[model samples]
Target: MEPLPSLEVIKLDEAPLAFTLATLFEPSSVLSQKLVPQLHEKLKSSPSPPTSYGELIGLAIDQVRTWNVDLQAKFISGHPRIGETKNLSMLSAKEQGANSDRPTVQPTPPKVLARLAHLNAYYERCYPKLVYIVFVNGRSRAEIVRVLEDHLGLAHSLSIDEPALETADPVDVGSQKWLDELERAVRDVGLIAKSRLIALNVA
Candidate 1:
C-alpha cells in the first residue's frame, strides 16, 4: 500500500481523459459552470455546434483504467473469496440450517460480480464513461479490478496488472494546485454547456 501518485499536477496529454480528469476533479470551474447554459442554448437552436464536452467526460473515465492496475490488485488481494483463499467456512455456517448436502449457498465471486455491476450502472447513469477515480483510496488494485471486471464483464479490455498498481503515488501539493485551476476551467466549461443546453431548449 504505497503512497499513490499525486494526480493534482500531472501533465495531462491532449486527450479526452485529460479533460475528463479536469472536469471531475474541478467541477466548479467557470467554464464548466457556463457550459450548462451553452448546451441548453445549442439544443434549443436547430443548428447546434458540435461540442466535445461529452467526449471529454468520456475520456476522463477512460484514464481511470490506468489506475485499475492498483485497484484490481487490491480488490483481488483483499477478497479471498474470489481468489484462492476463499472463506468457505462462512458459507458453510450460513447454510448450516439448510439441507447440508443440498444447501443453497451463493459464492463470494457472484456477490462481487453483482457489486461491480451496480457500480457500472451507477457510473453510466451519472455520466457517459465509467467513473472509478473517485474510489481510489489506499485500497489494493486487485480489489478494484475484480469489481470492475465483474461489472464490465470479460468483454471490457481494461487491464490492471500488479506493476501498474505498484507505481501509483498520491496527488502532491503542486498537483493539487494545478487541479484547482483545472477545476475552475471545468466549471467554466460546464456552465457554458449548461447555458447552451438551456438556450437550445428555449429556441
Candidate 2:
C-alpha cells in the first residue's frame, strides 16, 4: 500500500511482500535477520492478513518470544542507550530528538539527565540482557525522566507501565508507532529471562 510511508516497511500485501522482507532487517542484526523471513512467511500464510501496521508489529512481538533466549538477548543489544545520539539509525535520531544527552524537543534538568545516565549504566549492570525501552511518546523532558526513574524500580519486573507513537519522505504514524511499541515490547519481554535469573539468584 503505497510503500508504507517511509518507515522502511513494505506493505503487507502479497505482491511486494517478498521484495520488502528482503530488506526489512539490518543485515548486521541477527535478530532482525532471523525474524524478517519468519515474519514474511507467517503473514504470507495467515488466513487473514494483518489488519493494520500495529497488528504486524504484534506478530513480530509474538515471533520474538519464540526465539531462543540467547537470540533474544542479542536482539536487545542492538538498541542504543538512552540519550545516545551518535551513530544512531536515522529512525532513532528522528524519534529520540538529539539523542538522550541533548534533547531539543524539550530540555530536561541536568540533574534529571544525570540520573537517567546513571540508570542507563546501573540497569545495564543489573540486567545486561535487556536495554531500557521507554516509548517517549511526546512527553516533556521531565515526564520522560520520570518514567526512566519508575522503570528503575521495576528493574526486576521488566514491566511496561503505560505512557507510550510516529510520519512519509516522513514516516507514517502507524509504522513508526509500531516500531516504537514493538521494540519496547521486545525489551520488556526479553527482561523476563533476567527476572527469572534474578529470582533464581543466578543473575
Using TM-score as the measure, the top candidate is 2
Q: TM-scores across all candidates?
A: 0.19, 0.56
Give one digit per residue, the lDDT tens place, for model 1 in 1-203: 11212222222222332333332333323223333333333334424322444433333323322333333222212212222223333322223212323323333344444444444444333322213332222223346545454543333323323223323333332354334433443343333333322222321
Cα distance off (Å), candidate 2, residue 27:
7.7
Clashes of each: 81, 5
Tens digit per residue, CA lDDT, model 2, 1-203: 12332222343443354333222221235544676677767766678766654455456557877886557556656655666646754434444553433323234456655555665655554443455665554444445566765654433222232111000022232354434544564755334323322222333
Query: What is the RMSD, in Å, between candidate 2 and the native fold over all Cα?
Result: 14.8
lDDT (0-100) at residue 129 of candidate 2? 49
Worst 10 residues of 2 by lDDT: 162-171
Error of 2 at 36 (Å): 0.4
Model 2 per-residue lDDT at 66: 83
Q: TM-score of model 2 relative to the true fold? A: 0.56
lDDT of 1 at 169: 34
**In model 2, what lDDT does residue 62 have?**
77
Model 2 CA lDDT for position 74: 66
